[model samples]
Target: MSNAEMILELVRKNNGVVTAAEVTQAGISRGSLNHLVNSGLLEHASRDVYQLAEVWDNEMYQLQIRYKKGIFSGKTALFLNDLTDRTPIRFHMTFPLKYNIGVLKKQNVKCNRTKP
Candidate 1:
């Protein structure tokens, strides 16, 4: 399949979201990603993150994609595990030590650090 087709397929498979690393690993060029954005086929979600334009995205899923090591912890985990009746107001994500959280900061994510 062509690079563009492969990228689109990745997005489709991932519930309408894709990451730049995934694209690059598939041998698709960054210029293709730019083209998709410019052509309105994809919307940049955050740094290295893209979503199918206008699709509803799950924040937890997006966070996982954006930060591979991040996991729902604390309040967010309780809610997800049905151990808490109250809904979590913010995502509580824990990433391994030394993980860069620049993207999470940009998205106003509540992040914590942990040992791998």
Candidate 2:
């Protein structure tokens, strides 16, 4: 199959989201990604992340993608795990003690550090 086809298949298998890293790892060129995005076949969900155009924007998913090491915590975890009905006003994520939270602090995220 073509590079564009491979990228689309990757997005489909990943629940409508795929990353540029994944594409590169699969031996697909970044130009293919640009081509797909330019053709309206894909949408940029966040830096290095892409999703099918038909998929609805999911903030939690996008954040999770951008912060792979972050774990949803507190109200965000409760809501995601279906332990609470209330939606979180600010999403919370916990990371390793040494993980940098500088960038997360700029977003609408309540960043926490895990205890050793």
Candidate 3:
């Protein structure tokens, strides 16, 4: 397959989303991403993130794609692990101590100091 075709296939595999890293790792030129965006085939979801034009913005997707190191913890974990019936109103995220958590804090997400 051609470069654009390869890129599109990758996007499809990622549920209509793909990152520059994934693109490069797939042996496709990262620069080709701009071509796709300029030609209206894809749109920017975030820095270095792209998604199909028809795909709606997904919050969970954005979280997972943007923050690969972030983990769901605290009340969210309890609910997920079936330890509590109450739904978690907040998502406790644990990342490296040096990781900038300003963005998460801005969203009202609590940051854990250490990993479990």
Candidate 4:
């Protein structure tokens, strides 16, 4: 199969989402991601994540992809883990004690830090 085909296959396997890091790990070049985006087959979802153009924007998934170090917590975790039926008004995430939270706060995420 062609490079584009391989990339599309990867996206399909990933529930219509894929990341540049994943592509590189699969031995694919980032150019394939750009090509797919240019062709309108995929849309940039975040800094390094892409999704099928037709897929609805999953905010939680996108945030998780964008901040790999941020772990869902509190009400957000309850909703994500199916422990609650109500959606959280704000996303809650926890990062390491020393991790920078400026960017996460800019995204409107409720940032929490682990105890050192």
Candidate 5:
């Protein structure tokens, strides 16, 4: 298979979360990624991140995208905590003090970087 096809398969297996670093590690060039996006075979969900349009329905993929954006935490942590309950409308994520929490907060996701 071609590098782009291989990379696409990798993203599919990973629930649609693939980083540019990962693509390089997989021997795919950054140019190929740009080509895929331009071709509508892939979409940029975050900086340096790409996902296939096919797996967009996968909740895990959505979660990973949110996590990448720093808006996944709190009640959303319940998923990571092994608590079975209703899914949260907003996710919570913590960031280091040096990192700005503005984007997450703006998304209406709770930010608690100060907490453990």
Candidate 6:
């Protein structure tokens, strides 16, 4: 499949958001992404992340992508494990204490980075 088509397929399979690293590894260039955005095919939803314009279920995708750098935890982990009936208004994740960079501190999400 073509690069654009492959990118779209990955977005669809992953819900919506696809990592910039993944796109780069797939041989897609920044110019190509800009072209897609200009064509209204993709939208930049966060730093180093893009989502398909036609996809609607983006919350899960965003959560999963955010958790990609850490482990799902607290209410978020409970939700991920299907132990909760309510959806969290904020995302929660945990990483190694040494890797703690407070990336999600300002966002609605909660992050805990402690020694595992």
TM-score of each: 0.81, 0.93, 0.75, 0.89, 0.66, 0.77
lDDT of 1 at 52: 92
Lowest summed lDDT over 10 consecutive residues: which window, candidate 2? 107-116
Query: Which digits, one per residue and each the tens of the lDDT, describe model 4 over residues 3-115?
Result: 88998999999999999999999899999999999999999988899999999989898888877788999999899789999989999999999998988777868999997
lDDT of each: 0.85, 0.92, 0.84, 0.90, 0.72, 0.75
Please provide, for model 6 over 18-110, each residue's C-alpha lDDT reduced to its tens digit, 9 standing for 90 to 100. 877888887887666677778899997777778888766466566567556676779987987899998988877777888755656877767
List, residue by residue over 19-63, the lDDT tens digit for candidate 3.
999999988898899999999999988878999999999665577
Ranking of models by lDDT: 2, 4, 1, 3, 6, 5
User: Cα lDDT of model 6 overall?
Assistant: 0.75
Question: Model 3 off-target regions past 4 Å?
Answer: 75-91, 106-108
TM for candidate 1 is 0.81
The best candidate in terms of TM-score? 2
Which regions of candidate 4 deviate over 4 angstroms? none
Q: Give the candidates in order of TM-score, highest first.
A: 2, 4, 1, 6, 3, 5
Task: Report the candidate with higher TM-score, 3 versus 6.
Answer: 6
TM-score between candidate 2 and the true structure: 0.93
- Which tens-of-lDDT digit does each residue in 28-87 have in candidate 5? 789999999999999887667787777555454454554653544677778767795687
**Winner by TM-score between candidate 6 and candidate 5:** 6
Task: Name model 1 segments beyond 4 Å from true.
Answer: 100-107
Per-candidate clash tally: 0, 0, 0, 0, 3, 0
Measured with C-alpha atoms, the lDDT of residue 106 in candidate 1 is 62
Top candidate, metric lDDT: 2
